[model samples]
Target: MKSPSPGRSSAVRSMRSAPFFTPIRVVFSFAGPSARRPLSFFSPTIRPSAWRGRPWKALRLVPLLSQNFKAEVVAVLMLILFFSWCYCSYVLGCWRLNIALSWFWWRHLDAGLHAVMHGDFRTRHDIQAGLFWIYSLLSHRAMEYYYGARELKGNGMSKHWWHHIYPNDPGRDPDWSTMTGVAWVRRHTSAQWHPCHQWQCWYWLPVSMFLEPLFELIQVACALLEAVASLLEPPMNGPYVSRWAHVLGFLCEVLFNPGFQLVAFGVQPFWKALGVLLLARATSRLLLYPFSEVQHYMPEHILNREAADDSAEWVIGQLLCTANLEFRNRWAWLMDFLMFHGDSHQIEHHLWPAMSFVQYTKASQVVRATCARLRLPYYTVGYFEGYQKICEQVKEHRKPPPRPKRPRSPGEEPSPSESSSTRTRRRTRGS
Candidate 1:
């Protein structure tokens, strides 16, 4: 077989990288903030502007979204990169980069450095997040099987093992943790639950879409910084990386990161490189943002914060606190093929992390039916409905249901159904 071309490999890598949108999706979402309007490519009207200034306005955009298949395809791919660059802030004047979240991360990382000096933390929080990886992988098992880093059993405390082992413990279950944003809840949060949490419903979707791309960037930066910091730590604390090894690892960090790696994936021209990386990274991140925050971030997940630890067996714990979705959809295989698989069947993935994407459907069915037989919660919600539920929960979070009073008279105690009604009324009043 002929060797795969660099561009072909790059295309695959870019798709696998988180962050993207189809060119069509971008055009529709391109209305200005002030005159907000969705794209109308599907509409007979070519121009979707509220101003109705130029009916031909969309004609200029037509080359980018043509009727011709190959041209349209190319245009769409370019738009993904263009918009990704716009959102990722690789170029300015496209869109705002690092809005509400950039400051948050800045402060968070600053506090981390401060902790390295004082404030009860042993190491910088930034470094702590990384646990000091010279280079990281999407799956550490891939690292072990292919790269022969067999010592990294689940990458030793940084990977999903902690989440599987600890489930929903705020400290250990990485899935059940929050890195930043307002600290809510009286128990686990650094800040008291604020009235503002009610407005999260309003802001989270748009803000998360904007802020999510930076999340991976910030995470990688911290990881690399910790790796650098590790080099300075005592040998007992740091991995023994020789000078040559350090150089190689540093290159790997830059080249292996999804963003930079996408850029370097192909032997294409500069613009093509940018476009490819832009398409894959931005589209992946954009589609991922809405669902990503909702995962393990529903209101019930937060209410469980009263407990510091969990005792459920690992499998059951995953079923209890984690959620699943109706992944048996048209796009399930496409998502799987693109390498961001099984998230729609998140519980199944956790239960069998290394299972092939092709096998996930059967595995999911087995797990779901088994969990149902055992009377465990094995939720499988539609994609849009799942997001809708999460949005509703965010709005309702501030107003918890009122507690029922004990019976004073023989018949004073509310029955189970009555208690539910009374609770509903209180919740309504609180809202």
Candidate 2:
């Protein structure tokens, strides 16, 4: 048999290095809080990197001393979470909140990370990627418990309960208002013709990785303050009291918010720990945000209208507004998890927020066929292609045309200079 060509070998090598094509790189690309490092450390001595070296060694007797450690930490996590959900609902107001954006990575994801910290870089990468894959799948599945059955059972009245029933109202879609990434953009719905949006296709990887966290800092302050307040609040409407709970919780959140949970739990120094965590988050966001943020912004979606109006039928509204992404590749689910089922088949999600990511794909086919049969619009594109469209649309909107150059008179002849230029042009063409 003939040996494979040299060009094919080089092509295979190129594919591995091209980060977008690498499943491991793509999944870990957003290893921020969602990567879910531990909440607190039992041992202040063991380096998290070292924990990966020997997790058994890192498990000291400290956890045994505090029976309530898990409970306290879990409660704090819940507080930050609850405050966030409440805040988003508050901002979007009652008009536009169908569901949580699947944003929070549960405490168990962190717990599992702690348990499996012993591994090589590759092993740890797989663990972080794998853990989210499993947990998000489960969390979204559990969404049915809250949103009702997978079949879209009942349209309960409460804001949280009926999310799947009415997923993507321009006024009622939480995603447009609170999805994540840069505030005042993407998640924050605003009339925008910023040059940044125009050039996002070019600037996304760098600007997103570095600048986004600062934009997210406002959220950090809110979470920490809420934790602080919860700590200070008088239980059962009693008087205020200072306590260790308030201080410790505030400290943990402040330290932990910028991917410092590893610092709290493991052996890394503050700067080193933060630097490493930031790098991972930056890498993750670089790969993740453009696609995630651009979903609703795609040119044809027309989601940025200044005022709400009669949208299409609720299901058609989802298709009209949400960008359907390609994720049929074998490892695309990891990317799906990073993005919280993201734009990758987002229509399937909006139409049936109750469906698991797996089910979303199956359902997308049926939805697509139905849309085709009914002659409805279904916006599907490659993730990068979708972002390109958003940038172009933003650019198009930003540029106001030159005052439509006052129309030339119908019978007007050219000026002497214009006639000379026209003759010159004709001579050049003749040549």
**TM-score for every candidate vs. truth?**
0.45, 0.45
lDDT over C-alpha atoms for residue 415 of model 2: 83
- lDDT, model 1, position 166: 50
| lDDT accuracy of residue 218 in candidate 2 | 56
Model 1: per-residue Cα lDDT over 1-431, one tens digit each: 01112222221222223243222112122122211111121122321231133422322222211123332232235334433543454333221332312222222222222221111111132322231121122121122222223233212233344454455556555555453335432222322466666566666655454455456556756766765665676777534543224434445545433354432434445665455444445554445443554555544654443332344343445566667656555665453323323456667555443232334566666665565666766755666776676556555555534557766677577789989999999999999
Tens digit of lDDT per residue, candidate 2, span 347-417? 76554432223335556666666667667777767766755765554445444223555566999987898
Worst 10 residues of 2 by lDDT: 34-43
